[model samples]
Target: MNKTVFITGASSGIGRAAAQLFLQQGWNVAATMRTPDKEKVLTGANLKLLQLDVTDSNSIEAAIREAIVHFGQIDVLINNAGYGSVGIFEAFTPEQIHRQFDTNVFGLMNVTAQMLPHFRKNKRGTIINVASIGGKVTFPLYSLYHSSKWAVEGFSESLHYELRNLGIKVKIVEPGVIKTDFYSRSQDMINDENLEEYQHYLKTVFNNTQSSGTNGESPEVVAKAIYKAATDGSKKLRYPVGSPANWLLPLRKLLPESWFFAIVRSNVEKGL
Candidate 1:
């Protein structure tokens, strides 16, 4: 029997790529998104396009149940539904902050909670979280986005220890700057007319960020890394994808904290 992988945010980018990759490898894919009706690319045998909004518990439950009913079981759960909330921290409203955490942090936990009983009963499963290199290292104008991803990184790390005893695995896939719709459709920008002081700074940093994605790897690269984490069968935890992440994660660890921050500040703030 082939395994099944349930993925969120499968309408585009890494999630869509992963769904296609898994289906190619003979796995059933529950490719879920808020607007499944709009997705047209991924289709074929063993593919189930589902409607799932991670921020809504009822939607999450319905999608999971439907996938299990259709495919019998889901061997892997990929938490990939999230967006970036970028700009000056001061520009963000309380509601925006809540929405960011709702979709990125609590929303991830919501899906995981819904799937845990199924995974526990099976005694074998994998949870691959699609985090960002920003989780480990931060840049300018993405404080809220970084907060959510950083939460994901820590949560996955701590959960791995407990899940191991249940014969389940938890993994993190950190992509540096994949060429995806992240800056366009998959991101939200803070807008506060009162915060004119930060507009120029935000524009500079946002431009630098866009340049990184323009030169970054394709979404398929991170999709492949996610696939490896699911099938590697090892206790490995973090799988960093893309160029700068491959170098930056290690560099951040090797260099002093202040020095690393300085380098990041220079690159992002000064566009160096």
Candidate 2:
């Protein structure tokens, strides 16, 4: 029997790409999104489109239950439903901060919690968390986004130790700058005109960040990495994908704190 992978945020980008690739590779796909009705791309006998709001526990439960019912078992769970909240940290309202953590951190934990019992029973499974290279490093104007991803990185690392004993694996896919809706449709930019001091810095950094995203690799690159993590059958934890991430992650580790911070600041402050 072929394995089934349940993916969140499957309407587009990395999630959609992963779903398509898995189906093409002869695996069952439970492609989930907030508005499944609007999705027209993923369709096949082996694909099941379901509605899932990662921030909502009821929705998470319903989606997981439905997926298991349809596919009999889920061999992999991809926690990919998240958006970026960018801009001045002080400009962000409490609600924005809460929502950022809600979707990116708490929501991911909730989904993983729901899958644990099932995976434990089966004694074999893979949990792939779609994090960002930002999780390991930082960029300007993305404090909130970076913090949330950092939380994911820490959480996944700690969880891996416990899950390994249960015959379940935890994998983190960190993509540097994949050309995806994350830079637009899914990005939340916080701005305050009253904060005149940050305007110049924000503009310079935001422009640099946007340029990187525009020139980034396709989401398919990250999807391939996700596929490898799921099927590699190794205890490997972190799979960094895309161009700069392949270099930056190692560079960050090799360089001193001052050196790395200076490099990041210089890159984002090019126009300043």
Candidate 3:
């Protein structure tokens, strides 16, 4: 029997790419997003476009139930609905901080919680959380974004122990800077007129980040890594995809904390 994969944030980028790739590989795909009606692509006999906002438990539950009704079972769950809120940490308003964590960290937990009962009953499933290289290594102006992803990394690692005993696997995809709308429309900027102290430093770091993004891997590369994680049939917890992630994850592990910070500062912050 063909397996089924339910993906969040399927409107574009890694989620959309994963949906298409899974469908091509003969799996049923539940391509979900906030606005499914606006999605013009990834339609076929095996694909079910769904409206799901991870921040809304009702929407998450409804989408998962509808997907189960349509596909009979969900073999994999991909948590890919998140955005980067970048800027000076002190400039971030309470609302912005809450929104960032609500969508990235808490929202991911909500979806995972909703899927657990179904997955436990089935005795076999996979949860692939799309984190970033920033999850493991921090950058200058992405304090909120990195916090959320770090939370995800820690959550996935600990959750793996509990879920594995139930025959379910939890995986984290740490992608490097992928060439996606995330660098454009999907990113939120923090602004505070009173907090103009860090303007020059912020601009330099932001410019450097944007320039690096132009040379990063495509979303499809991360999609392929996600697919491998889902179907690899092993207990692997972390799969770092893309160039910088693959290279830098090891560097972070091997190097001292201060050294790693220095390297990041030099490459991304200094002379920027």
What's the TM-score of each model vs. the native?
A: 0.97, 0.99, 0.98
**Tens-digit lDDT track for model 3 on 33-84?**
9999898988889999999998899999999999999999999999999999
lDDT of 2 by residue, 166-250 (tens): 9999999999898999999899988998999999998888998898889999999999999999999889999999989999999
**Model 3 per-residue lDDT at 82:** 95
RMSD of each: 1.2, 0.6, 1.0
Model 1 over residues 138-198: C-alpha lDDT tens digits?
A: 8888899999999999999999999999999999999988888898877888767677887
Ten-residue region with minimum lDDT total, candidate 3: 190-199
Top TM-score: which candidate number?
2
lDDT of 3: 0.93
Backbone collision tally, model 3? 0
What's the ranking of the predictions by TM-score, best on top? 2, 3, 1
